[model samples]
Target: MTAVEETQQAEAEDFLVDKAKAVEVEVPDAPEEIGRSDYYTAKEVSMHNKPSDVWVSFLGNVYDLTSVVSSQSRELESDGSSLVFPLIKCAGTDISHWFDETTGDIKKYVDPIKNMMTYYIPQGRFVHVPPAEPVSDWDNSFEVPWWKDATLKVGKLSASTRSLRVKNVLTGHEHLMEVPCEETVGQIRARYLEYNAHAASYTWKALKPNEEKELVFQNLDMTLNLQDNGIADDQPTFEALGISSDFHTPVIHLYYDDDLTVA
Candidate 1:
């Protein structure tokens, strides 16, 4: 090849190499998750572990909690101020295990902050993440960890899925009805009474599957929580009634009749 032609080819090759290098140096950002499938790997999440860019992996998701304590000053002397940073010490770490150790129902604490969170609303600070949709059902995915409070949801952590089912057995009926696990017996009975108007006046009885003996709907002794709900308007949950894990305990039987004799 001629020297001139060789020189031109070399320049073209160098140009291509520089372009490829530019693309290689670029860091791909995690997708913006707006309540859909935006996932991040654990290694990718670790990048933001520093205090200035704190992130947390929770419930199979990565959350950027940098915003939560960003404005806090260690020197400030607010009441119980010492506790603030400590609680969020897991800022850039996977807090799922810790969070689970703290509570089974995270929404109970998270939902309260939707309208207002005095702790994060510092003096003269207008920075606040807008509230997202509230989770109406217990089984809802809306309980996204990073979505709560000032934590900016960076991305979701991929994980396996889980589900639960509840069965409602009715008296004078031959079949059991499936219900959502989070539903209370009271909610199911009210619906049953609404549909079965004739049985409305009947006293209600909850029984174990295939067992003739009625399962006493004790006044609020059991719940899927750490604390007893204390005789909730309805009885304990079917899960709390020992119907959760065992199918052998099949059919949470519900009986309602104006007369015990009729039941």
Candidate 2:
């Protein structure tokens, strides 16, 4: 070949070599395989030796692994055979605080002051239940009790009169009377019965001073006498009767001639 052609061929070969070096081939990531513990491998993950800060997703809710412990024995089924761990325990941080230095086992703290306000799943492990399909029907066809129609009226009284007016619109009854501006809630109950004789059997009481009662009054506007008692003045205008705030709302007991039974 001619000298010029040979030089050109040499340069082309060098160019091809540099081009191949410049091109990069990338390796794709392999598909992830499910781990043996992830499936039904019969291997149990023990929380006994785990750290107190480990979080566990149990029964669809995330829980502090250190707050609970497993007490009961559980069996693992693998390859048609059952493997039993009689004393295998899983403990969380809650159990960590009660750790016994002597036995190396967790101490049960049942009445934890800090956990009183929180919900706990107790120290036992539970099987997870799959979620079911939700029902879409939202219409309620059931009839409510007749006593639900009753309501109470609450309002504030003028300072000069020292009297408040409470009315039960359902029975067409009105109670207008004087009350001690500083009267306690207990005294208000007594006064309620004094002015309204019909209220004697109904047992009407203030849930909240100067506030509406859960009994669902037709008119919430009513005058309250602050001078009768100071007890209710500082409390919520609306309050529930009974020691527990979770009790059912107070309702007026009604009697029908046909049944004559208090409903």
Candidate 3:
């Protein structure tokens, strides 16, 4: 090879060596507490697509890979950025297709020419993935691949989604949002904080009729979902009867407690 070509190859090898060293460094422990729902909607996961705040769902679980991706991104040489581009492009998205449902690992297929099984990465390999062929700088000493690391898992991706309408009785304000079906009332309130800063200071309840048919507000159990608190989602029943779901959206009324604790 020419002098210039040899120099370029050496530089690429150096970059890979640096990356291998970085990979050996241990990642920080996952947070002690998430203080959020155990379930997440696809919309919620899509909001954190940036390298500085990336999240992705695979095999029904959500993982926050922001720290790892951001740290590696900062170390990338201009010419070597493409090595991690697949991860950046897939941030805040569901990548369940890339993994095997039974094994919960990246999918593999037989190599056409080599007649051997190999990892199938159509988007190109990213960090922690071993090279297709052995190289001088390649490292596989890490105990676990990022995809198999449980420490990065944050929550489960909700299997189903539902629309909820939360109305503030004191301020006459209302916000409609999509929520995970598996979330509790308390978790839902946490999600509501984005719309109302004082969501926790409000008394959440639902209006229902007594034996006399007079409507009254009943306090909700924060630990339970609407159905468990006596407000079931009847949208499916309504639709089965040929009624539009929009005609009967479940509404949760909130009464402010006049607390100033939360700004």
Q: Estimate TM-scores for all models.
A: 0.28, 0.19, 0.72
Which residue segments of model 2 deviate by more than 4 Å? 1-161, 203-263
At residue 24, what lDDT does model 3 achieve?
87
The sequence of per-residue lDDT tens digits that candidate 2 reaches over residues 1-263 is 99999999999999999999889555434322211111110011223235333333222122333322231123222332211121123322122322345543333344465443321234331222111223343222324211111111012211221335554645656655444443432344455645543332332333333444343322111232233322223222323332442232322222211211211
Candidate 1 residue-wise lDDT, 1-263, digit = tens: 99999999999999999999887744434322122125555555667766677777776667676655564434222243432354255555665543433443232223364664322322211122222434342223333433354346666664421121223344445433333333344444443443554433343333322345554453221222102222122223545776544344333333332243333
lDDT of 3 at 43: 93
User: How much lDDT does each candidate structure score?
Assistant: 0.43, 0.32, 0.82
Task: Say which candidate scores most in TM-score.
Answer: 3
Instruction: Tell me the spans in candidate 1 whose CA falls farther than 4 Å from its real position.
Output: 1-37, 74-81, 100-147, 160-263
Best by lDDT: 3
How do these models rank on TM-score, best leading? Answer: 3, 1, 2
lDDT of 3 at 150: 91
The deviation in Å at residue 176 for candidate 1 is 53
